[model samples]
Target: MFREANSTLVDREWRIAEVCQRLEHDLEVLGVTAIEDRLQDGVPETIYTLRKAGINFWMLTGDKQNTAIQIALSCNFISPEPKGQLLLIDGKTEEEVGRSLERVLLTMRTTASEPKDVAFVIDGWALEIALKHYWKAFTELAILSRTAICCRVTPSQKAQLVQILKSCDYRTLAIGDGGNDVRMIQQADIGVGISGREGLQAARAADYSIGRFRFLRRLILVHGRYSYNRTAFLSQYSFYKSLLICFIQIFFSFISGVSGTSLFNSVSLMAYNVFYTSIPVLVSVLDKDLSEETVMQHPQILFYCQAGRLLNPSTFAGWFGRSLFHAVVVFVISIHAYAFEKSEMEEVGMVALSGCIWLQAFVVTLETNSFTILQHLAIWGNLIAFYVINWIVCAIPSSGMYTIMFRLCGQPSYWLTILLMVAAGMGPILAIKYFRYTYRPSKINTLQQAERLGGPISVSREYRATTTTDRERSCSIINHSTEEQKPSLRTSSFRFS
Candidate 1:
């Protein structure tokens, strides 16, 4: 057979090599050979922990189906026969592939009520056919399955799978250690490359490159959670502070007969975001809602990030309502305190602005989970700077705010108005926060309480997710802050080629 095939491929060297390789594969083995390769330490535990943290993993490889299944079983990626069912999808013709896919889908539905695990195994040929003609059905199958293994696939096929997941609105993370995985890594929402024996091609092309695959656990559970938390607070607080000032301006417009009249001068508007409110939120980037140890222990806390509990429409609405409420308090209190007396618009503006500054100071203090000396300085020093800058600006004879701060400083009424605004603006919010922290605390709140009291967090079993399905379902909605989901983290050392 080899001689005949070689004879037919006389001038085509590539075709001759392909024909010879196919002919040689069916021959009986003269001897058995095995290579001893071991996984890195702590890999299985890391995967288990991350699975509990709500990340679903799919194995895509160039190895044969049996080899991939063996590796998956050894690594605890899927359970064996009794506990888990591996549905195979394959065929040469389009019709055969469709029939196989439908059968698997039917089996999945049949076992939908069972506690047994389900995973679908597909080879390159069937995947190609399914993706071309039955992508929607394939997508549903992938989503329903606890895990999936795509074996005997090409580099492009891996990327195509990633694209399909993304098209279904699921965020994907592709991690690879070699050149063949470069396309897949780049195609994912986030690309993580493992710098190992395979090569540097994937690492160089990836968004982040890590030295070891096991470090992925920390990358996701600890650092990934922190990044999400910090980014959510920073982005939302930015909008909150800006909206606070804007809402005040909109209220001022009503009293000014809808005419365009600036409440605070141009300088104050410019300085509010840059100097006054910027530091605390910037410092908040270093804030941790829970300790690293606690986060690692309670990986289920990641559900908040995946579900966007921190910065979703609900949280945004809360911030929006707070800004509007504070704006109203500032405007009404300032206007009423100076109603009968002869007061300049500049003085009223100063009164409202001072209230804003003080209220912001306390808001940051209230929301802070862990406070360091730096945070104290950023919050308090910023308040001091506001006063000092205003005092200096009022001293200048030509400035619009001239004598405004000085007059307000001398009056007990100015101080009273500010006190009144702060109380009215933040009193309800602080009360609600206290009530929730004391009575209706979440797991995060409990963890935060433990951190504050410097005690060990004793998480209840109920706090931990019971099933893998529940955990993955919580990870369905990527946080809504960015147009794209926050970049996920994954790491792989498999040589796809």
Candidate 2:
């Protein structure tokens, strides 16, 4: 009875102290409960894949520092090999925290030249101090470390860390499976939520939700990269195709003394987007340019996401130049085939229309590698539809809209001229394609070389070097072309860390 009374008095004193100090709770002796939390399968392999992709992995957990470290080891985030180095920072005072950060910075600077195999484990207090006072130093330390763990961190701290990284120009990706992670998920550039035993609050808040963590490997490396590449290609192709058609019409206007007349009739214009040109791009969207094995073999492709590597100013200019060239070829061929004075205006218009349609078809066909039966049908269907529409419009009485149609669909020479013009216009484009194929450097060869060297870092260096060299070449070309005025192009290199 006396012991119980003493314990009550002590608890009362603790509660009063907590109220006065604004502490979390009073420390009292309580019964311990042991609960087992098993990790999901394939987590280690997933972490390994991310590491190979040059992604920095961090764990912000409410668990104790030791528990977090043990889980990190089991997940292969903390390597078991002797080559790994663990840097611990758990200081209670500002001076202690400063000293710990200084030590980490010193170690990082000393080993900056080598491939680092370091992990950092810091408690909440130390993290707060480092972030508040020595943020730049902390950022450098985190960038150098292979993995980082912040135990006893609140959800707010996780979000703050993500924001800090984003401010530093890092494309942060936050993945979590608990309600406590919702803020972090929202804070990051890409939020991936794991639908695990914790709950679905994080999943609801995330941009993408996955059943297992291992799936993130495929999600980011395969699907993400594919989406970016495919979108870039499609966007460039769409602009090029449209610009080519527009330039052709502009050329026709010049020949016609700036008449500003429409080249194709309403029906053909409608069919171009809805039927003739949509299938190849749709198919290309689903097309996998590189196989899974290729991606896994050369993880450097993942780095392309950092900048506009796939689609940039140089590529856009190339597409524009090609579009202009192709437009001129088509126009010159059609005009030469049917002389401006010899042929009627309607005849010239029909030839121009047919050439434009066929050019679009050729462009679509060239964009794809292999054609499926459905794509083949779409292409043929567009041609058949155009001819059938022309026949119907011709069969109708010569009216307000059918006057041009009546003139164009008259003789077999009209059809023959179109076919000849299409064949003629394809020559330069085909030659250019062959030239590109013959001289273009093979990416597969570079990947094979990197594999033979047995170092992914070498591949990364080679890619950066190639990018730098290309930028220098482009700058030199600009300088030579415009000697009087100099153009400044920003050449910022990507940092994987």
Candidate 3:
């Protein structure tokens, strides 16, 4: 934020600022209107979406201070339209270097037709300027951070601001496309490199890469919040389903061993694990978010770890029902098989068991997430891989220990259904605790109108449409090149992702 202060310069700095201001004034008087238009189109749909989603944007630049302020206002990057904004910082000394180079090049111009000769003279002048007067230009920058929207900053100052923002625990993102910005980009939490034609170091350090700022809205505003809810939902269902499947497997194991009846054949066990157990878990975690207020949590899971004080009778009965059901089925089946003659096992039993497990898994998938069964791609893929491995392991002729653990082939009889009891007992308990997320109302209203300007959106070539009066227009200065200025401590303007 620049204030007209008592001169501390050798009297030349103020002269330079005044001359530059005069040049811009003359350009406007000559009808060379500065370009400023609304950067964010003011359609209600945009406003609604932005507000509903809750994300903020700030526009920082190395352009003239007034111009940056004007652009910020025009784009509504700072605030809602029509409210005046603050002018925090203005740094445009880099333009002076180009002017100096221009003069030097013109002096050497003699219709040199040969590009190499022209380039040689240009390089000489640039090198000479760099060798002298770099610091003289930088000391003029003022850091008015408390109320200022912008600051005339140098590379060191830019890096210092990064440190300051970091101290506040803000998840800072810096995006840029130039060499001068690499320092700030590296220091940020997420650095996105745009216009990589300039370089790749910045991009290499970034968490995500994208082509433009327009794509950033979905990531920051919408998907960010959405991912949070999705993850919580997935967590509940996957854990619930896992517990249920374990009980079913245990039940069939006892039926085989005790009742002299087969439970799951090797293939069936593999199918249950591959198709039924892991799919929901994989899908639930695919989209992850860590937003604080709009988290999806299940009520059963939320209070389970609390204590007996909150324990309800219904909760314990849930397990009782499942256990009783499994016990009764096992008792009837084993008694009948033991009392009567045993029969040869049919492939249908194995098929039915596998099918039942798959169905159970599918139903559980429906509990918490909006995703249809097919979208659980990672879960399904991993299941297939695990199934192949399980089959290979189980088909081994002498692996009695492995067969016992996972419920492999055995006699099909009801007396051996103790394993089934274990499975039925666990399923529902897991379901209530982990399979459903209690949805929460979003705290998106807490999001504020963004930007340091505090009022009009600032952007280049976009604020012109918003300015009606001369003062608003004057806040945006259009340079017509009077005094040549060079960026003393070349700092880059960056896009923070």
* Top-lDDT candidate index: 1
Provide the lowest-lDDT 10-residue window in model 2: 474-483
Model 1 weakest 10-residue run by lDDT? 476-485
| Candidate 2 accuracy as lDDT | 0.66
User: How far in Å is the alpha carbon of 336 misplaced in model 1?
Assistant: 1.6
Cα distance off (Å), candidate 3, residue 192: 2.1
Overall lDDT per candidate, in order of appearance: 0.77, 0.66, 0.39
Which candidate comes out best when scored by TM-score? 1
Better of 1 and 3 by lDDT: 1
- Candidate 1 vs 2: which has more lDDT: 1
lDDT of 2 at 263: 61
What 10-residue stretch in candidate 3 is worst by lDDT? 471-480
The digit string of per-residue lDDT tens for model 2 on 1-497 reads: 33443457457766565565654447685789765545556667766776666566777777777777777787777787888888888688889999988887787778766665787788888999989988888877755564677788777888887776676556678777667778888888888776644567878998998765567778888888888878887898888878877887788778668987866566666666676566666666765555666676566567565455678888899789878877776678768767655866555656776776776677667665446787766666666766676667656665223555556667676677667666766776788767765587346345544554665623434233234224211000000000111123211010011
Give the per-residue lDDT of model 1 (tens digit) for 343-417: 888877888888889999988888888889999999999999999999998899998888888878898888888
Between prediction 1 and prediction 3, the one with superior TM-score is 1
**Taking the tens digit of each residue's C-alpha lDDT, what string does model 3 give over 1-497?**
12333344567677767766765664435456443322312322332333222222333344554555544444333443433223221123445654553443343343323222111111222223422444222111111111123223344444544544555433455665555556766766656665434455655656666554344444544454455455544544444444444554466567567564444455555555455565655566544332222222111111111122122355345434543454344334433443244432433343334334443444444433334445555445554554455556556766432443234335453324434533553466556544332243111111111122245322222111121221110011011111222234212222542
Let me know the TM-score candidate 1 reaches against the reference structure: 0.88
Candidate order by lDDT, decreasing, is 1, 2, 3
lDDT (C-alpha) at residue 460 in model 2: 35
